[model samples]
Target: MIGIATFLYIYGYKYICKAILTAKVMFMNNLNAPFPLLQSNKVKFISSFSFGFFVFVFLYIFQPFGINEVQFYKPLFIGGYALITFSCVAFSFFGLPLLFKNTFNPDKWTVKKAALYTSFIILIISVGNWYYTATIGQEVISLKHSFLKFIGITFSVGIFPTVIFLIFTEKTLRKVNESKAGNITKQIHTDLEIEEEKQENDIIPQIDFLADNNSIPLNQLNFLCIKSEGNYLEVFFFIDGKLNKSVIRYPLKKAFEQVNELNNIHHCHRSFIANFDQIEKVSGNARNYELHLRNLTFTIPVSRGFSKDLIAIYK
Candidate 1:
């Protein structure tokens, strides 16, 4: 009986550990997944200030907190909501990311992340509102009794618009990029073909690509772009019409130095040096731009500093 019980306990413990490991993996996968978000500090600043104004306008118009019953100056009283909102938003979107750099990377941003972040901000807003209600309101109100009420009101008023607007905006931007990227990419392919024909006899320049204890030549490889990834550059190129990539131990800044003579190749992003000949189209407006490369799954982001340079080359 004792042997049978021991066997069952060990098996149960092993399965429980396995299940916990699986759950942990799933949770980490959601958090660490590389989700594309084109947001920057500029975007966050705009959103934070805009949300504060929205709160001001919302309170002024709605008067939801029985503010009509209060005898104090209404605009001055309601304006506090705006300040509270602005502070909370500025902290959540701007300050939190700065403090928690490892957790809030834009490259790995996810919808779940946005939703959770929005919810967290809203909760803080609710707490602020609750404190305001307790300290500033007319009657002697019991704090615990009305705390949940304030939370409910805050979430109802804020969450729907904030979360939905974010999701909608992301979806809309992606659609525009997808629609425009395909057309632009096709045109680029055509342009490359024409340019290839024009430069058929031109001598393709050869440059040395730094590698692990050696150098690699460029002319033989036909590399389309190079991406710097932690002491290695991921080099993309074509071989007999098939796309391929080669990883080399090199720095992107050095690669740009070597390829300066190549007019078609430009260091378009901090992490990327792109051959404009292989770029399908430049996406986004003057404020933000992205490069769609030929036969590549992801679009390369073009930082503001490099946008003018790329636009000049493309034109």
Candidate 2:
């Protein structure tokens, strides 16, 4: 049982590493975009330490190796723990970034694509672990027993936890984005009002039509709205409280291009971009700002770093 478990663990880990590396190489070579790679040494070290501690605690409690018959503080025990920790750290340092690099690229993977990739990776890992465990042992266990054991381990320790984590993270990110958007809207509106009063004119400067593939006539634009469509963004200007509903010319990264040039336009959140001219009112607290734009109300959050900028714009 012990040998089978060890083999499963090792095989699962190696397969995950290889899969991630392959994905990373493919993304870098095939897709030429400036996406962030997963190369955080600090995260790798911390994860390794945590994994090692968990393994140590598990072994200590279970005494799986009949530690009561031998010295618990043996040199072999320390060496084993060290090896596991180092191996995990090394693997994560190389593997995680590779996976992230491939999965995070806007040009390469859409939300559906990313989800499919994750499912495939998980399936491969689970099956690989099961096969390794079933075949490694000398004692012949029934196929049913091995299958059931594999299912139990996978559901309890792998799939369930990962799914829960993803759900929680997604919820948190949504809230954060909403709050940021509200704050940006408020700031832009306040700035616009001040500028308007000074100039004594209601007309806001609009972008002149440029004969470029990227250029859009300012006259054709009405209200800038940023909507999140999974990993992609849907950008359209509202016409009389209705979505103009034109196809987005660029991805989220490109949509944000030259945003600084638009004096009254700013990205309120990762999922939302807004125009100050469209904002009707600002409500909510420091952490959460709500914007009333015509008939629509949206929340924008103020991250700690952007708080000063937000305040300055409003003031």
Q: Pick the candidate with the highest TM-score.
A: 1
The clash numbers for all candidates, in the given order, read 0, 10
Please write out the lDDT profile of model 1 over residues 185-216, one tens digit for every residue. 56677777887787777777777666676565
The C-alpha TM-scores of every prediction are 0.51, 0.40
Model 2: lDDT equals 0.51
The 10-residue segment of model 2 with minimum total lDDT is 136-145
lDDT of 2 by residue, 1-315 (tens): 999999999999999999999999887664442222223466446645654555456545654323334443443553354344445444545565476775544333333553554454444444654554356421222233366565555444444434543464455544654666566666676666686677654454566322225454343236556566765555556555565544443555556554434656667666666665666665544233545665454444433344445547666
User: Local error of candidate 2 at 304, Å?
Assistant: 21
Off by over 4 Å in 2: 1-103, 106-114, 120-152, 175-179, 199-276, 280-292, 297-315
The positional error of residue 82 in candidate 2, measured at the CA in angstroms, is: 12
Cα lDDT computed for each candidate against the true fold: 0.71, 0.51
Question: In model 1, what is the error at residue 105, expressed in angstroms?
Answer: 6.8
* Collision pairs in model 1: none
TM-score of model 2 (CA atoms): 0.40
TM-score of 1: 0.51
